[model samples]
Target: MDIRKLDDRLSVAPQITPAEVTEAAALGFRAIICNRPDGEAPGQPTFEEIERAAKAAGLEARLIPVASGGLPPTQAVAEMARALDELPGPVLAFCRSGTRSTILWALAQAGRRPAAQIVAAAREAGYDIAPLAPLLETAA
Candidate 1:
């Protein structure tokens, strides 16, 4: 898996195959978050398939899908934050390009983290989270 660790508790990566779930477990991730809705792309694996794999690997899974580049709803952001807190440490979240996953993570941290901190973290992980600075400020 081409995983990018965004922080100690979270990582973001491109879509992962069900087969890769075992590998993720081997890498010490305790949970999986699928941000891409099923059928967003022609060949994208359904969340069910990935969930099955995650369960088999003894990892918890959550789905909070958002369309590509779509602004994450407040509820979804809240849910992401809850997942982060409820799930075990070192969770992995994925979308088609990993950008959406990173964005969602940023949104989840909005009020809890400074915009610069969140943006910089995402940037280091190869995602431009600067666009979210305004929203983060409002959230703060």
Candidate 2:
């Protein structure tokens, strides 16, 4: 996994394998958040498979899947916020291209940080988040 650190407390990556969970644990990550829903594409490992590996590796695991291009559900954003608050850090969240992971994390950070900062962070991490401006305002 090519992990991209979003900040001190969070990192995001593209679809990760179960083996990567061990690497993540070894790297001192305390939790994993899966933003990709199950069966979203052919050949993708189910979240349960990853969760099991994460658990065995002694990492908390959460699945908060969000569809591409759709606005993140309010509940999903709140869940991510709760995860950030409750889960041990630093956390590693992943999805296809790592875009969804970054997007969800950005949404959770909405209002808590400047929208420009959030967008810049995502851009720095190789994601285009200029479109999330409206949602980012919710957190501003």
Candidate 3:
């Protein structure tokens, strides 16, 4: 897994396999969040499969799938916030390329920080988050 730290509590990674769950547990990630929609790519493990493996490894897991070209739902953002509040840090999330995952992460953090600061942090991490600016404003 090519994991990139977004902050002290959160990290994003490329799609991971069931085999990586144990390693993630070992690394002290208390929870795993899958941001990729199931069946988006052939041969990708279903969210259930990863969730089962994560649970067996003693880590919490959840699916908050995000569709491309659509704005993230309020429930999705709420669930992420619940995860952040309810689960112990640090948490790890994954998607096909990590862009969607990072976008969701930033959105979930919207009202907690300034939009400019969030965009800057995302940019520093090599993600163009300009499209989310308007959404962040509304969310805030």
Candidate 4:
């Protein structure tokens, strides 16, 4: 698992397998948030498969599939925020390349934190979320 720690409460990564979900739980993650849509790539594990693994490992899982190469919709952002609010801490969120999940997190944090702080957090996590700074400011 190429997990990039974004903070104490959240981490992001590329596509993860069922085995990785268990590993994440073992590593102290309490939940899994999958942002990748099903069938996005050949051999990509379906959300159901990962969900089953999460369940078996006693971790909660939620799917908020964001289309590849596109920004998450407003509803998707809302859902992500809800998950962050409702789910247990130390959540692992993933999508292809982990960009969608990072973007969702950044957008969800817009009003709660300064745009610069959000961008800096994403930068620390190895994602260039500065492009969304304007959008974040609008909400901030």
Among the numbered candidates, top TM-score falls to: 4
C-alpha lDDT score of every prediction, in listed order = 0.92, 0.91, 0.87, 0.94
Model 4 lDDT per residue over 68-133, tens place: 776789999999999999999899999999889999999999899999998998999899999899
Per-model tally of clashing residue pairs: 0, 3, 0, 0
The TM-score, computed over Cα atoms with residue i paired to residue i, of candidate 1 is 0.97
- Per-residue C-alpha lDDT of model 2 across residues 19-131, encoded as one tens digit per residue: 99999999999999999999989999999999999999999999998887777788998998899989999999998988888888899898889998999888888889898
Candidate 1 lDDT over residue span 7-125, tens digit each: 99999999999999899999999999999999998988999999999999999999999887669887888889999999997899999989988988898898898989999999999
How does candidate 3 fare on TM-score? 0.90
Candidate 4 local accuracy as lDDT?
A: 0.94
Which residue pairs clash within candidate 1? Answer: none
Best by lDDT: 4
Model 3 clash tally?
Answer: 0
- Cα deviation of 103, candidate 3, in Å: 1.2
Look at candidate 2 and give me any clashing residue pairs.
110-139, 111-139, 111-140
Off by over 4 Å in 3: none
List the candidate 1 regions with Cα displacement exceeding 4 Å: none
TM-score of every prediction relative to native? 0.97, 0.94, 0.90, 0.98
**By TM-score, highest first, what's the ranking?**
4, 1, 2, 3
